[model samples]
Target: MKRRKAIRNIVLFSLGTGIIYSCKDKYEAIKQLHLKHLIIDTKQLDILDDLSRLIVPLQNIPELADHTALPFIMNMVEHVFEEKDRQAFMKGYQSWDQEILSIKGRAFSAMKIEEKQQLLSEVNEESLKASQELYTVFNTVKEKSIQYLTTSEYYQRKVNYYQMAPGKFKGDVLLVDLKNKNDE
Candidate 1:
């Protein structure tokens, strides 16, 4: 009887241990970034993702679940930007959020859209002039995100329609106001 009880206890203990060990850690480190030139890590990418969502042109959308321009911006930084610029941008980004936190008393991820916009409005060159890092990070993300939004397929299709040809037709033009010296 005692042996049976001991066996049962051991089994239950092993099962509990297995369950606890198998469960995923809530604070698991994010996956590492795989950029050729830029050296951003997972945490920085997450921060950049948040920043990208804020700086993008589409403020009307409620949930930008996966519409971040991170890939495009990262690609631009990796390919188009020179080594010096990339380094400067990254150097600024590493601690840029602290400036906003100081003013808003909340993390960028925690702030609402309006709060973010207000904080960003205050991050101009004059405000961040004391720290080039803060300015660099804010400016880089803002400029690149806007560029991505304006040139994106959705923006082109929905917001800014492309014009294949420059001329337009007017159906109700009056001949009396014609500026032509000779009627053609």
Candidate 2:
């Protein structure tokens, strides 16, 4: 009887582990397929990745690139954004490249780290001060990018929320009276 129970427990544990592994594999496959179908331009995608890295750089913990946040951002832009907003975002994205070229006389990716930082700072300032459609679009994309990154599964898992234990509810539990305890 003891041997039979041991065998049953081992088999159940093995089966549970296999199921968990298979589910993880399936999820990754589905995510890859979704990314493949995304319609964003490749260069634009690279720019987004660079910007995301700048916005949320790696420190003691893993960065946006480690969690594949760029693809997630692209997926959001493709599916979550309204048509008009998507067009505006695309226009703003293109203007970012053009603006960089006009200011630095080279591609943004080719600039030095200090130069990139200065340029991004200028862009942020301009976005706040200017009321042009381009600036509005830039601000929209920046806000969305930050929002998506902070709320993403990877970020959540790496940060505090994942570590918190859920509290249990007990409807019939007697409430402790502090005054009674003091009297006792």
Candidate 3:
């Protein structure tokens, strides 16, 4: 009995170690893929930030840039977007930059605000008419930006929409007798 128990413990330990190493290997592989594919450069990040600000301009807020939305959008793009969607976004982004350069003979980052707006409008119209994938990318960025901004604590606080916990529970509200015709 002791020998059988010792053998069972050894087998369990070996299996557990094997499973742990396998999980570790998978984690490393995922990390490598993220590093190679999902990582964005500073310039690209700046471009995304500028594009987001253009898409969702803050009117009453004092902040010049989107503090919450941009980061959230970036995080979603990195972690939540599927492989095909990520590829589509990358392709669309590159094409957008090329279109801007071809049209204005300058980098998008260097363009004036009016020029940027005009370019964006033109591209938006073209994307809507020409390609569903391009349109999806554009709409995704805009929608995600709006979603993150609206859901942010800062925006909620600014709008005075934040409610305390256990919010507004009515325990003993009187119910009207809708079934009785005379009660009305």
Q: Which whole-number lDDT from 0 to 100 does residue 177 have in model 2?
A: 58
| TM-scores of all candidate predictions against the true structure | 0.57, 0.55, 0.58
List the candidate 3 regions with Cα displacement exceeding 4 Å. Answer: 1-36, 58-60, 63-68, 103-107, 124-134, 164-166, 169-184
> What's the CA error at residue 7 for candidate 3, in Å?
50
Report how far residue 112 has shifted in candidate 2, in Å.
1.5
Task: Give the range where candidate 1 is weakest over 10 consecutive residues by summed lDDT.
Answer: 18-27
**How many clashes (backbone atoms < 3 Å, residues ≥3 apart in a chain or on different chains) does model 2 have?**
0
- Tell me the tens digit of each residue's lDDT in model 3 across 93-139: 64655555665788787888898787678766674243455555577
Candidate 1 to truth, TM: 0.57
Q: Model 1, 114-143: lDDT tens per residue?
A: 877776767753553336766777778889
Inter-residue clash pairs, candidate 3? none
Q: What is the C-alpha lDDT of each candidate?
A: 0.63, 0.57, 0.61
User: Residue 4 error for model 1, in Å?
Assistant: 37
Which candidate leads the pack in TM-score? 3
TM-score of 2: 0.55
